[model samples]
Target: MRYGLTFLALSAALAALAVLAGGAALVLLWPAMSFGLVGAAYLARRPALLGKRPDGTQAAWALVLLGPYFLLTWATWRAERALGRADCANEVVPGLWVGRRPLGDELPAGVRLVVDMTAEFPAAAAVRRHPGYLCVPTLDGTGPEVERLRELIERLRGVDGVYLHCASGRGRSATLAIALLLERGLAADVDEVEAQLRQRRPGIQLNAAQRELLRRARARPGA
Candidate 1:
C-alpha cells in the first residue's frame, strides 16, 4: 500500500513537472519514467510475483512507458510469444519444448506431458491443473537428483510432446534437456547436444557444475 502511494505521488510529480517545463521530449519521457517507477515499486514489494524471470516484467514495463495502456496489453501478448522463442522454449525438436515455469493454460495444445524441474512449486495455480504435470524438484548442482532425472526421462520416452522447464529455463532446464538428448541417442555426445541446443536456441548457456553433471551422466555405465 505504501509503495503504491509512493508510485502515485512520484508519477504525479513527474507528470506535473513535464507539463510545467513545456518540453516535448520531457512530455514523452515522463510516461516511461512513471511506468518504470511503478514497475520498480511493485517489484520491490513483491519480488517473487514474476518468480525468477524479470524479463517479462521488464518488457511489460517498457511497453507501458512507450504507449497507451491498451497498447501495453497488446505488446505484452506479443512479448510473451517472443519470449517462448527467445528462451528456446517453443520447440527444441519435433515434439520437445523447454522453458521456464509455465502455467498449464499457456502450454501449447496437445502437450502430452510436462516435466517441471524447478526446485520449488510454481506460483501459478493453473500449473497444477495439467493432467500430465510432473514435478521433479532439484537444486542447481550435480547431485543424486541428476540420476533420478535421467531415470525419469528414460521412463517418459514413449510419451510424445514433452515440455521440460525450470525456474529460469536457462541452466537446470537446459541441463535436463541435454541429458535427455544424450540418453535417447538423439545426439552423439555432450558437445553435439550443446551444439544442437545452441543452434536452435541461441545464447543457451550451462554452468560448470551443470556441464560436469552432463559429463558424469554421459560417463555412467549404461549412459
Candidate 2:
C-alpha cells in the first residue's frame, strides 16, 4: 500500500511539473527545461511504471533515463559558454561602440552593404537608406520569415561586407547574427560584424516603435 501511494504522488507531481513547465516557456527558456526534468525524475523513481525490473535492476534503469538529461544539459551549457566567449572577443574592437556585450555598434567603412532588421529609429532608417537590403521581423528560430532571411542573404549582389543594424541591438538583431553564423552555417566573425555598425548614430536607444516591434518579434515561438 505504501508503494502504491508513492507512485500516485509521483504521478501527480509529474503532471504539475508539466503544467508549470509549459507556462514557463512563455516567459523563459531554461526554466522550462527544469520542469521537463521533473518528469524524468518521476520516471527514474518509478521503474515499475514501465516494466517490472528484477531486484537490483532499478540502478540500470535509472542510469538509462537520467543519462540523456545530463548529457543534454552539459551540451547546452557548453554551447552557451562558447557563445559568451565569442561575444567577449568581439568587445575588443576599438572603433565599435557596443551598447552591451555582443550588441549594437558602428558601421565600418568597407561595409558598403547593410541588412536592416525592422525596428523603430534613425538606425533602421540609416540601414534602409544605405546600399543594401531590408529583412523584416521574424520570430525566434522558425517560420516563413526565417526562409525569407535565407533568401535575402543568398540573393545579395557584390558587397564588401554586410552590416546588420537594429534599434538597441538586443533580441531580433542579435538573434539574426546567431542564426546566420550558428544555425544557418554562415561564417562571419562577431567582432568584425560589430565593426560594420555606425558608431556615430545616437547610441542604442530604442524609441516606442522599435519597442513594439521587438514585443511582436518575441511573441513568436522559441524566441
Which candidate achieves the best lDDT against the true structure?
A: 1
lDDT of 2 at 6: 46
Global lDDT of each model?
0.61, 0.37
At residue 129, candidate 1 shows an lDDT of: 59
Best by TM-score: 1
lDDT comparing candidate 1 with the true structure: 0.61
Model 2, residue pairs in steric clash: 106-197, 106-198, 106-199, 107-196, 107-197, 107-198, 108-196
Error of 2 at 212 (Å): 21
Name model 1 segments beyond 4 Å from true: 1-88, 120-123, 141-144, 221-223
Q: Residue 188 lDDT in model 1?
A: 84
Candidate 2 C-alpha lDDT tens digits along 1-223: 2333443455455556666778643433333343344344343433232221222122344344444433443465447546643232122123222222112234555455455442112132343445544444322111224345455545542323555443334444544443343222233543333233323332223333333433443344455
Candidate 2 versus the native: TM-score?
0.31
